[model samples]
Every structure is written in structure tokens, then in C-alpha cells.
Target: MLTKRIIPCLDIKDGRVVKGVKFLGLKDAGDPVEVARVYDKEEADELVFLDITASFENRKTLVELVEKIAKNIFMPFTVGGGVGDIGDIRNILNAGAEKVSVNTQAVKLPQLISEASKRFGSQCIVVAIDAKLVTSHQSPVTSNGQGTDKWEVYINGGRTPTGLDAVEWARKAAKLGAGEILLTSMDYDGTKDGFDIGLTKAITEAVGIPVIASGGAGKPEHFFDVFSKTSADAGLAASIFHYQEYSVRQVKECLREKGIPVRL
Candidate 1:
């Protein structure tokens, strides 16, 4: 079995790490490079750096910051936000990112997913889907008949609703050559309640690619719950790690004790 990964997400805005509840009221956490260095030492399975406002502000991801973080950490690094085309993907990869995550651009021009995957290899392409739950009456049923409720994809830092079903989009992304799905539940993001297990499982079953469950992780038990209750390959959290609420090693230890395979 594949060991479940614990990833720390750095939501970057103006080149500094920030965290917000449900994608609003942002607060500075620390310098991106510094936080990344700490997680690197803590043996985090991977690191995700997202330029939260890059798409909204219409700018490329801070390549310099990515290079700085990459140089400081030895683990796999994934960078997202403001990746508009294949050129942008190449720039980020050359800057030392192991993977490039595309959201708004992929939704706007889905061909970008196929183009980037073909150019950079599907292993380097990740499709990030930020989704918010919608009532059954408001949205269509998921193509994968795993559930009754529905989720709509949100883009531009979760500010715009794209009216796309989350599970369907995951399936499409996989078919388009995306190697992985970074699914973040906007409703649970930063709430620390727990992951949206139902949504995670639905997408996991809908697509063959690995799914990294993001948002709503408060305690170590929350990570355990995600891996136990859903088929997600990874659990991602920001505030808990950024605020020193728990360490990566601590979470891994907890998971291992619970009989969950994790790198420790």
C-alpha cells in the first residue's frame, strides 16, 4: 500500500505566507522560505506553495520565491497560482518545482491541461479544484453515482463559482492527462473541523489519479480520519502547521500508531 502523505500548504500573498478562514480575512503566518524550511526538517512528505492572489491580481507565481524555497527544502515542491500556459509551467519547473498546479487557467482553457501534461509529462501536472458544496436542487448529480449531494468548482481563489461539478471535473482532468487532483473544499478550508470526507471519497472514486484532500484539518486525528474514511492519497493543512498547532512528525506518529501507513 502507498503510505499516505502529509503535506503543508503555504498560501502565499505578496510573497508572504498567509492563512484565512473559508478564503477570507487573511492573516500573515510567516515568511514562506522559513516555514518551508521548518517543514522540510520535520520530514513533511511534500510542500505546496500557492500564490493565493496571483490569479486574482493577474501575475505570475513569484519564481524567485519558489527558487528560494526549493533551494531550502529537499522534498518534492508543488507550485500553483498564475500559471497561464505551458511557458509558465516550464518556468516554474525550471525554478525547481517538481509539479505545477493549474486552476483558473485550466478551467478557462482545458486544453492547457493536455498541453502541459504532454510537454512536461503528466507526473508534473496537477489540477487544483477548489469546490464548495451545493444543494442537490441547485446542482446536478455527480457522474460517479457515489453520492447524492454536489459540489461546484470555484476559481480565482474561491471567489468565482464555475458551475462545474467537482467530481466530473476531477474525471475530466484525469482524462486530460493530469497526474493528480488537489481538491480543496472551500467550505472546510481553514475551519479545522475536519476534511470533507464525502466529497473526497466521491472524487477519489471518480478518478484514478491520486487525490490530495485539502482544507479543514485541526488535529492529528483529523488527518487520520481523512486517510481512514476516504481513499485520498494525502491530507493537506495550512494553519495547523503554520501556527504550531501540531508538527508534521507528530501527525505522522499519530497516524502510524493508528495503524495507518505513513512515512515517519
Candidate 2:
């Protein structure tokens, strides 16, 4: 079995690390390069750096910052936000990112997923789906008599709703040659309540690619719950790690005690 991964996320804005609840009311966390180094030292399985406002600002990812962080961290690095095309993906990879995550651009032009995957291999392409739960009235009815609480994909850093079903999108992204899915729950992001287990499992089952569950991680037990209840390959958190509420080593230790395999 593949050891479960614990990833620390850096939500960057204006070239600095920031954390916000449900994608609003942003607060500065720390410098990106410095934060990356700490996680690297803590033995985090991987690091994700997202330029949260890049797509909204209509600019590319900060490759210079990526290079700076990559130089300090030996683990795999993934960068996202403001990635527009194959050239942009190449730029980020060349800057030392092991993978490039595309969200708004992929939703706008899904062919970009195929193109990037073909050009750089699927292992280098990740499709990020930011999803929010839909109300009963907005959701479709199912056989169980309860309205299916569908997750709708949001883009532009969760500023726009695309009316796309999250599970369907995950399936499509996998079919399009994406190697992994970075699924974030806008409803749970930064809340520290725990990951959206239903949402994570739904997408994990809908796609063959590895799914990294993001949002709503409060404690070490939350990580255990996600890995135990869902087929997700990884759990990603920002505020908990950024604010030093819990160390990566602590979480890994907890998972090990619970019989979950992890790289300690």
C-alpha cells in the first residue's frame, strides 16, 4: 500500500504566505521561503505553494519565489495559481516545481490539461478543483430520497461558480490525463473542522488519479479520520501548520500510532 502523504500548503498572496477562512479575511502567516524550509525540515511528504490571487490579478505564478523555496526544500514541490498555458507550466517546472496545478485555466480550457500532460507527462500535471457544497434546492434528487449534496466547482480562487459537479470534473480530469487531483472544499477551507470526508471520498472513487484532500484540518485526529474513512492519497492543511498549531512530525506520529503508514 502507498504510504499516506501529509502536505503543507502555502497560500501565497503578494509574494508572502497568508491564511484565510473559507477563502476570505486573509491574514499574513510568514515568508514563503522560510515556511517551506520549516516543513522540509519537519519531513513533510510534500509542499504546495499556491499564488492565491494570481488568477484574479491576471499574472503568472511567482517563479522566483518558487525557485527560492525549491532551493531550500528537498521534497517534491507543486505550484499553482495564474498558470495559463503550457508555457507557464514549463516555466514553473523549470523553476524547480515537480508538478504544476492548474485550476481556472483548466476549467476555462480543459484542453490545457491534455496539452500539458502530453507535453510534460501526466505525472507533471495536477488539476485543482475548488468545490463548494450545493443546497438541496440546487442539488439533484437521488434514489435515497435525499437530495444529493453535490459539490460545485468554483474557479478564480473560489470567486466564480462554474455549475460543474466536482465528482464529474474529477473523472474528466483523470480521463484528460491529469496525474492527480487537488480537491479543496471551499466550505471547509481554513475552518479546521476537518476535511470534507464525503467530498474527498466521492472524488477519490470517481477518479483513478491520486486525490489530495484539502481544507478543514484542525488536529492530528482529523488526518487519521480522513485517511481511515476515505481513499484519498493525501491530506493537505494550511492554517494548522502555518500557525504552528501542530507540527508535521506530530501528525505523522499520530497516524503511525493509528496504524496508518507514513514516512516518519
Candidate 3:
């Protein structure tokens, strides 16, 4: 059986780790390097650093942060946000990112994926989609509706809503050459209730690429619930692991007891 992966997400803004609710009211978490090193020591399966604020020339800043963390972390690391083009991907990979995640930029120009796959191989490209829930009433009354009930694609720290269908985007991204999909539920983010299995399962079935279920994971049992109920390839979380509220080893132990395969 393939070992289940547990990934820790670091949402960086202005060089600090921050967590917010439903992608709002952000709070400072800690230093990126510090948190990353801790996760590395704890033997996290993978580390993801995202600069939620993706506008402006964020590439330089992100590369520097990646360098800092890479110096101390031995595990696979992924860096995302504000990646403009193939050049940016090379820059990030050169800076030590094992993988580069693209969101807004990919949405803007999907050919970047094909061009990118040619340049760096398909496995290096990951498409990260930020999604919220949309209800029946919120639909075609226009598939794009108003308020929190809508599943809008948020970029730039939840400030930009692309009004694209999350499910459709996931399929399109895979067809465009994305090796994996990092799907995060904006609704359950930071709430730690557990992952949004409905939304996650939808994407998993919609796309052939590996689906990493993120958002609302508050406990190890949550991982079991997500994987058992749905085919999400991995579970990614933040607050629970960052605040020392949970550790990678502890989560893995709990998962093992539940008969979920994990990397100890």
C-alpha cells in the first residue's frame, strides 16, 4: 500500500507565517524558517510554503525564504504564489524548491503549464486551487453567486475571486499538464473541524492527478476520515501543527493505530 502523506502548510505574508479563517482576519503564526525547521526535525513528509499575498514582485522574496528554509530542512519542500512564468519556476527550482505550485498565474495563462512541463518535466508542476463551498441556491442563478455560499477561486490572500468553477478548473489544470492538484477548502481553513470531504472527493474524481486535501484538519482522526471516505492522496494542515498543538509523529502514530499507512 502507498504510504499516506501528512503535509504542513506555511502561509507566508510579508515574510511571516499567518493563518486566517475562511481566508480572512489573518493572524501572525511565527517565523517561516523557524516553523519549517521544527517540522523538518519532526520528520514531516513534506513542507509547503505559500506566499498568500501574490501580487507585486514576490518572486525575489519567496526565493530568499526558500533558500533560508532549504538550508535547514532536508524534506521535500514546495513554494508557491506569484510565480509568473517558466522563468519563475526555474528560479524557484534553482532556489531549492522541490516543486513549484502555480495558481493565479496558471489561471491567467495555462500554456505556461505545457511550456513548463517541457522545460522542467511534468512532475515539477503543481496546481494549487483555493476553493469555498457553493450551495444549490447559489447556482446559475449564475454558477457565480454572491456571498460566502459561493465557491470562488480566491488569489492574493482571498482578495481576488476569479469566478471560475473549482471543479472545472481542477480538470482543466490536469489536462493542461499539472502533475498534481493541491486543493484547499477556504471554508474549513484554520477552523480545524476537518477537511471538506465532499469538495475534496469531487476534485479527486474530477481529475486524474494526485489530490492533496487541505483545510479544516484538526486531528489525526481527521486524516483517516478524509482518506477513508474519499480518495485524497494527502492531507495538509497548519494551525494544529504550528502551535505545537499536534506533532507529525503523534499524528502518524494515531493514523497507524487507525490502520492508516503513514511515514513514521
State which candidate has the highest lDDT. Answer: 1
Root mean square deviation (Cα) for candidate 3: 5.5
Q: By TM-score, how accurate is candidate 1?
A: 0.89
User: lDDT of each prediction vs. the true structure?
Assistant: 0.85, 0.84, 0.80
**Candidate 1 residue-wise lDDT, 122-205, digit = tens:** 999999999988865633222233587689999888889999999899999999999999999887787788888878988998
Best-to-worst order by TM-score is: 1, 2, 3
* lDDT accuracy of residue 37 in candidate 2: 68
Candidate 2's clash total is: 1
| C-alpha positional error of residue 149 in candidate 2 after TM-score superposition, expressed in Å | 2.8
Weakest 10 consecutive residues, lDDT, candidate 1?
Answer: 20-29
Report the C-alpha lDDT of model 2 over 39-156, residue by residue, as the tens digit. Answer: 7888999999888768534344388777887887788989998899888899889989999999999999999999999999999999999998876564322212123568899998
Q: Which one wins by lDDT: 2 or 3?
A: 2
TM-score of each: 0.89, 0.89, 0.86
Total backbone collisions, model 1: 0
